[model samples]
Target: MYDWTQDKAVRVLTRLASEGLQTDQIVDDIISHVDDFRYEAQMPTFYFLSGLTGNKKVASKVASLLQR
Candidate 1:
């Protein structure tokens, strides 16, 4: 069984980013959830944050989080 909740979050975040919505806060929220105990939750958050590496607004924050 899979946790759809995490998938839903990732999908929503991706959609929001694709639409040029409030991406900074979206990235920040994703970064904050990177340490989630659930692999389902953590991996998607990490992947999403990783995909934002080229985004200037949140790149440093994502890089800092990735370095930890």
Candidate 2:
């Protein structure tokens, strides 16, 4: 179930990225639900997305998200 959830997240992120929408916002929203992520699976993508945004608010949010 955990691995499956991670895969869904990756798929959703990929679709959102390809759509060329506000991916950073989508990433932030997903990170806020970090409990649904696996530490080594879906999370690294969120961390990278957060870093890519270069926004302090997003980075800080994801940092705390990772702590959970």
Poorest lDDT segment (10 consecutive residues) of candidate 2: 46-55
For candidate 2, the clash count comes to 0
Please write out the lDDT profile of model 2 over residues 21-64, one tens digit for every residue.
Answer: 77667666765665556666655566445444545655776677
TM agreement with the true structure for every prediction: 0.59, 0.46
Against the correct fold, how does model 2 do in TM-score? 0.46
Clashes of 1: 0
Model 1: residues with Cα > 4 Å off, grouped in runs: 56-68
Error of 2 at 51 (Å): 5.5
Clashing pairs for predicted structure model 2, backbone only? none
